[model samples]
Target: MLIFLSLYFLNDIFAFSGSQDLCGYCFDTLVNSFDKRNSILSPSFKNEQHPIFVTWKKKGQLRGCIGTFSPLPLHSGLQEYALISAKRDDRFRPISVSEVPDLDVTVSIMHSFEQASRWDDWKVGVHGIRVSLNDGTSIYSATYLPEVMSELGWNQEQAIESCLQKGGYRGKLNDRIKAQVQVTRYQTSISKMDYQEYIQWRKAKLTSIRGDL
Candidate 1:
């Protein structure tokens, strides 16, 4: 299991329709990082804060995935995490520039958090879950994004148990442990862009800029 910490706070819900432009910004950030140049594109969205996750895939397989539970300004946060997920995810080696063309990026903006009555109280596909367990010695925490449960075909119990293991809990699983778990459920609006699509978007943006000039 990949190890990543998860934490959140209750806040007023904000409207965000995950946009292709957001994913384009991520791609631009990453390519610039690889080239050791500053990003040439600015995010067009408002600079509102939200809990965001950036996930990278290569040829339909998980290459890297990382994000923050804390709210962060959209522009800087996406810029920061685009590189972090690609270059800093410890589950895999740093993504090389050569691999950029084969990669697809997904940006998930998380919102609508609610405390679950029980570990299984939330809908599987609709909610991303964060689970925390205190076993009288230490607290273990982990999260799965909203798309994860449906993608993996996991029931609520299975997802919770898997999240526990991902959080580095080696203890026995029983009613006692399940009863002790604290669960927070949330949702995300996501946008995905493949490398080719990113390239096309970049070209169109440049064309539009030249036309205006």
Candidate 2:
């Protein structure tokens, strides 16, 4: 019975929709994003837009992270963000196809972006913060995803300061600095998979198909 339950859970991992696991679209994008290809595996996602961030990590360090606040169709958004995050993130060098085998992909589907009453209004682990401030000349903004604070063991002030620094602010962080900022708190539903997991799922799927023949 234990073996059967374990297999049952493994079967669920390979199943795509509503499972919070990487879907076929993610694997397809991982391949096509570097090839400059434009084909999509399934167009079943809604035509409406959903704000998304694609993150790539190699050996548990950040390789790339880029996305948009503007909502776009999930099909195109996933593909576009995947490539952009992998290759175009200005903070790091481009990811090569050779790095694919060691990579982990995380898709963050963002929602409920609400203007926070203050910088400290949101909870650390629950909210992803997007902060913008005009320091006399131009507006600067940066965002950190929900898991960032919890993962880094950052308090609310530390998280906000880090985000401010990310936005290109080199000025002193103080109550005055905090007062001018417009903070929007959001949430994300994330799905992730590593390359080895993807390969395993592919093998399992193929084996299942062959067994049925």
Candidate 3:
């Protein structure tokens, strides 16, 4: 039977939400260098859509952190950002496959985004902040995830200033600049994966495949 169906309908049939074990998918992505857009992921990992940040670290030092504010299917979002953070983050050189053995990947699922009533309206350790400023000619914007402030031991003011600097602002960051910026705060749910975790996940997958065969 031939029937016409809307993309939205297909999306509704596919999209899902809630707790997920994402380590396996990420491990497969790295091992096979697979594109998530074309890869098969567990339905549990693709049920809901959200804005996501993919962070990579080695020895507790930041290797890369990149994400989108725009919501996307969780599977595609994680896969796209995983590769992007590992290879395309301008602040650091691309992470090689050799480095993958020691890399730790953290996936932050963003939600509850709301505009701040004031620059300091959000909590320092509980909310991620995104700030934008216009100097009448150009607009500059940047974001710091919630963990950034607590990890760096920064107060709200310091975090805001650092975000401004990240936005490529060269001028002094004062109350005036802070006043002119629009601030948005958000919260996230985080999942982390280490090399050992990836290995265990891979072994399980291989076992499953062998049993199926």
Candidate 4:
């Protein structure tokens, strides 16, 4: 069975709809099916905004990460982006199907992109950041959580460097599209379950939860 994306990033994508009280378990089946994803792109609330970053991990080691600095079209919503981060990031090796069983996915929901008006607002942990320069290009990076700074032991320079390196920032500062950004980052995680097992589990859960009797 392909334990590919089952239960990955469920918590991060669904947290804002708290009153709905949706759990990650449920999200495994009930995806954020909105094709024109409002939250991940141009969010309805101030907290949700464009150019967000996503990172994935399995058994506490880095797996994958990908995001945008400028607002990507909502058509490329979280579902697609999450999958891209999983199988496509070049940082580490591609996540093998074997690593699926022990994996866990964590996601960071970043705040609105703000130009670096004041460098002080940029805290390594508390901020999910984007850094860019003059041409028409930009960078994007986010952590699994605000605590990642302490856990990773990174300072601002390291964080900035990371955003630059990992997020595909190319060329000199005076070149490309120049822009400095910061975000109030929030995060969430979901236990990675077997993809086939999750599918079966969901069929059972839905039948039991949304019972006809």
Highest lDDT among the candidates is held by which one? 1
Scanning candidate 1 in windows of ten residues, the lowest lDDT window is 1-10
Query: What's the best-to-worst order under lDDT?
Result: 1, 2, 3, 4
Kindly list the per-residue Cα lDDT of model 1 for residues 1-213, writing each as its tens digit: 111112332232233464788899999999998676645676668787778999999999898999998889889999999999999999999999999999999999887777778878899899999899999998999999989889999998889999999999987678999789999888888899999999999988888888988
Q: Residue 72 in candidate 1 has what lDDT?
A: 91
Tell me the tens digit of each residue's lDDT in model 4 across 1-213.
111212343343455433111123222312333222312222222233334445566667777766654444333444556666776776677666566555544434343333445333566645544443323354454333345666789886665556555556544332122234442333332223334544454466556756755
Each model's lDDT: 0.85, 0.75, 0.73, 0.44
CA shift at 6, candidate 2, in angstroms? 36
- Write candidate 3's Cα lDDT for 1-213 as tens digits: 001222222334223222225645655566557344434434345445567788889889999999987767767777788778888999999887788778888777766667888899999889999888898888889999998889999999888888988998777878788789888887667777788887776666667768987
Compared with the true structure, model 2 gives a TM-score of 0.81
> What ordering of candidates by TM-score runs from best to worst?
1, 3, 2, 4
Tell me the lDDT of model 3 at 68.
88
Local accuracy of candidate 2 as per-residue lDDT tens digits, 1-213: 211322223332223224323344566677776675634445444544567788889999999989887766777777788888988999899998899888888877777567788889899899999989899998889999998789899999999999999998888779998899888887777778888887776666667768978
- The CA-based lDDT of model 3 is what? 0.73
Residue 151 lDDT in candidate 1: 94
- Give TM-scores for every candidate, taking all chains together and pairing residue i with residue i: 0.91, 0.81, 0.83, 0.52
lDDT of 2: 0.75
